[model samples]
Target: MEPSVYREKWSALKNAPGNEDALSQLARQIAFSFVDRYYQDGLYRAEYIDLLCEMATSFSDTQFNNKASSALFEIIVEELCDDYEEMPVEIYSRVMSQVISYCRDVPEGVALDRRLTDFGISTFDDLYNRANLVHSRRYTYGAGRPPEKIILLSRVTIGADVAILSVMIQRFMKMFPDAEIVIIGNAKLEGIFGGNPRIQMRRLSYARGGGLFERFSSWHAALDILQTEMPPETEQNVLLVDPDSRISQLGVLPFTHSDNYLFFNSRKCDESAKHSCMAELANSWMHDVFGAGDFCHPTIWVPSGVRLRARRITESLRAAGCRRIIAVNFGFGTNPRKRLSDDFEIELLREILKDPRTVVLLDRGFGRNELLRSASLIADIGNRGFHASVACFEDSQYPRTSHGIIGIECAIGEVAALIAECDEFIGYDSACQHIAAAAQTPTLTIFAGSNNMDFIRRWSACGDTQCKIVHVNTLADPGHVDTDEVIARIMEERSGKAPGAVEPAHKIPEIKPPRRTGKQAKKAVDS
Candidate 1:
């Protein structure tokens, strides 16, 4: 009979036995029966270890707080070595507690056997399980044939990529209405995909042995979905749209036989000239994910200047009952552990806000408290005349956006809307600045007008070319200026009286003379 069944029968036998010795013998039989059934059947490895540890703990703590019981517990610990490498954290913690309890019971001179003393396998197992739990709860790239393929590309919290996620889901539904899209991410990523039947979601929790493997396992459901919808027999083409920047090399994917192509959905190569090395690598990864040998994939790159919906910022500001708004985008790239000083970007913002007539709306993710300090400095400057307010979304009443779903309370989409409503946008180079430009707001971008300025000028897509489109440098004399210079230029241009646009002293356009290919052309130039 099953050990559980035998144990139950023994429980009844204890009540019906003739004496205490008989009951004790039956109890021993029951314990051995459980070990035999569980171990031999390979049914409850975890349960067996837990039960043995509990028995050893109780025995050491009460009756056998001596050499014999201590030795027995050590034997039990050694026996568990094979499976300890993959044991769950909860189980490991329970077993470790029992081991520690048993160790405490041992007399001062009682030494653990050399074989039992070695904790390398057990400790590694425990740590591995713990790490797995952390990763299990995070975003995963799943495996095998899934019913559908839903890929999330994000460098930080997935919330910042909500615009892309939402668009992808909507597009996926349009392409495959009957199918379900599985979203695999952290606990904080739940509400973002809620109320969508086409979306089946799972949270990866490392706390529950949901580490990297578990994270990968969550994607198994996605693989199941992909397989169902896109079987091998059909030879369906799968395109990987990676916007978060890391692109695998051009080759066969590590797993699966599906003919798939990777697509990078970022504007990395839109500039007229080359970018920095890191920027180039980010673009390269996107292509590599698509199996493109070179970094640039002409056929696959998303045409530059794709339009996103004008998430009306001016309207949101008006609804919030604010007027004469100034959106300060003081976002800078910095590592969390690094201490921040007044960099070039911060210096420019301080000088720009010297005029009291401007209000400041700050993007909070720039550099932690560094951003707050920059805003505070700007606030100090603006206090003399105009009212200044920092834009934040911590209020529970504020509806959750993609960023809020990821616990990054402030939403870039909302900031974009505010910039649309504001009189001017000022900031260092960042995605927030790009979003503002997309919103058609006048923007003052603080880039030193050096060699890189040529690239910046070509890439900038802001509609209003007046006061907002000015660029500055770190070493510019008299710091930076804040005014409606762009507005002035636009008004003058409209009135057909702008000095910059005014015809030069010579009305005729400069034409290139013929190339000096021969002596005649050279002589004409010399004359």
Candidate 2:
């Protein structure tokens, strides 16, 4: 063998047979030499590149001092280049990419693992981080393919922030009607539209798993699915709504592309307590990912228009005596641990029947208590007592009803239907809020928190004139206040008691900024 070949083989097996110390030392020396030599010439022969990659991978398998491991990893990555001759372009590119991933992650794991051992906290995040390190190792360093279509990704079903999702969807429809809107969830909340022509849905299987690794695997797998299944001619404007605080901190929001990348953050206002910290972390993340040339974006506050539409439809339907409407909720379907029992909803049946204007609409899948409670709240103050037209709205199968108080299964346009039929909205802080708002109907939104109210406020086309937000003091002390309070507020605002008090005049309606006309998309990415 030639001198270099022998040396490569020796370094590759340096950590063999319990000689970890020698192995680590040899790896460090080789790493330093490669980085130093490349810094001088700004290039590497194909043979040297291959050897360096192999050495780094071998070093990655070793358990060494965390700092030393980190330093070695950095050196290996700093020396990486795409130029090579011996291997096919494809294989060379793949190997080089994998090597760079190891350089970025393995050393970080080595350090994090050691640090965690000192403090002793065994949590899901630790496991997730470890898996992330391994996952990063699998990544091959190469340029990403240009996106076919830039999508605005929202995980509306994962949490209860329906109000924000509804407004965002409406704004997206208004701003980019030509662009395809794909929601990253399987919830049937869109069923309200009687089948929306513009929106598409994709499911990420994060909800099925039991373990931390499974969820991470699901998330990573979803990313792969997204990349692989994307069409050849898709738009290149992807935006992910990352509301989670911790993950946003890790810089997941500032996604990269072949041409351009942009980070969106809202400054700390009164909207979300978590907003300031999340923005701070996102700022750091932007710096790490994009080197910080203004990571913040202008944000606008708005109301949930979907709820307004739904409430309006509910009112119209009641006027028509459409008493068989089911409140099927495919979204938020069955979380026994978190949701109230159906039997509890059934108890409100008495209050609903008192008005003698509506009847209970029942279905097998619909939870009775939940629907009844919703019915009671909506029916409580109407001139005539009210009842649910349908028991369930969330369903894969279509219902026969021409009119009813549909729940979570429906979509934006359905609010128009509800507005045309129903008397008032009995909507929660879900996407229906925006739909109701868009329909310009009386809506009462039961809010859990004030986060994302900015976007929520814009969906209400009446500029907060048609809707009222009701929030309890605490989650534990949950109790319904009289809807009259909200009704009074709505009426008072509509009467022009104080236009400034209801919605500030300075608050602009939230909408996505148009792409720059003159610049290439990559310029946007860079900025």
Candidate 3:
């Protein structure tokens, strides 16, 4: 053998025993390079991260596979939660995509043993657990193609519900280009979920009267529609997404006549920072559970009429010396954790009043709570010496549905139009923020301190550079936010000021785990 051949053999022997470190370091370098080059916008991050993670999985050996995977994991964790509890959605997608890819290659019935560590937290266990979950589940499509048609069962109820479906539907359309799409949801969704060429909407009739008999009749009608719409059971690859899965709970899942199903119940996701984001959870539940990998952002169809009216309305506001209209929707009834105290809302509005070039447009009519909050807010307007004249309204339906009590598509349409015209939208952890995202407007989403960082990262509207999140941290007393500083940042953000120039009050609070004696680390890793 040549002298070079001997040296190569010796080096391979020397390095093969402990080369994961070098490989990991190289992977880290590559990850940093990727973020540096491609981190221009939110959508860009998603594209590039997807590409890299997909490419990384192709290398199944040590030099590229394990170390690169480990590096990608750490970089993902750092980018997502190093400075804050969550990274942007694109980054989160990249990490999750990498996890799926890794799971794809992991041996069956095997626990992954990468032993990689980021921030002294080894994510091998987490990735392994998630990977195992991904691997073990059986999707109906099996090794063949996806179904010819996807039937999403009827359960559309509110604005947030529409917002969640927007992106997922967009992604599904892209993923299964030729696949027929059918939405059997509330009749109101016809407007909110209209305008897609591929989508065929079947109006779902539900009980409007809040009566047991009416609801019972409505449910029967829905069942009849479902039975009529679904393809034969022998038909291959039909996906039925009963998001919020109440039908399955009612034992009517068999009626849908499709084996592939994804069901979600909204419990155990609030209170602590330990949940996956509401958005991501929705998508991931469908993805991991139902084997649908496509994920997209909320979509809103801005009708020309609505757009024209919004522009005219905004122009009128500008004509009336309303400097920058700051939209506020601080009331959320989904959970108390998402609801801000009236005092906090008032304090922030009072702070905003100090700025002369700014005007606050409160959301007064979305929910019943909002009506009360708005009344209180208007009552407190005198405290800041701002008159009722600042609250601008024409014949616009935007004011009518500001409280969002009745979530009809017409109301959502008007609100979407109005939000599209606003400079900034401020809302709590609810669907209004997602609507702002659909409008491509800048939003300041004040997140409640939920222990599930995954939930926050996935669900919160961060896929756009314009969306900013300030989260509450609770070590023991748990919920504390500097509302005043949040207002200042909101103002600076609205005025197009650089972030670092402003005094920082927003934080991604450190989450303290409940004091349990055993397996805190394991539980955290699992969580």
**Candidate number with greatest lDDT:** 3
The deviation in Å at residue 407 for candidate 1 is: 19
Model 2 lDDT tens row, 1-527: 23285376555565453565665555566556655554566454444444444443444333433323343334453122111112222222333333333333444335433433443424434433433332222222122542234343443332222333443444445444565656554444444322455556565544321211222234444454456544323324444443321122222212223223232322222322222222233333333332323333211112235434444444544556555332322112332322223332333333334334443332223357654555543354232333233323333343332332233323333433443233334334454444343333344454442233433342222212244554422235435534445444433432343222323324321222111122111111001
The predicted structure with the larger TM-score, 1 or 2, is 2
CA error at residue 400 for candidate 3, angstroms: 18
Local distance difference test, per candidate?
A: 0.36, 0.36, 0.51
Give all TM-scores, in the order shown.
0.38, 0.42, 0.55
State model 2's lDDT: 0.36
- Give a tens-digit lDDT track for model 3, residues 189-238: 65455545677777766543222222334444555665666645534466
Candidate 3 least-lDDT 10 residues: 518-527
Sorted on TM-score, highest at the top, how do the candidates line up?
Answer: 3, 2, 1
How big is the positional error of residue 301 in model 2, measured in Å on the Cα after superposition? 22
lDDT of 3 at 378: 75
RMSD (CA, Å), each prediction: 21.5, 18.0, 20.5
Model 3 earns a TM-score of: 0.55
**Model 3, 225: alpha-carbon shift in Å?**
1.7
Better of 1 and 3 by TM-score: 3
User: Which portions of model 2 show Cα errors greater than 4 Å?
Assistant: 1-148, 158-181, 187-196, 208-210, 229-263, 266-420, 427-435, 447-465, 474-527
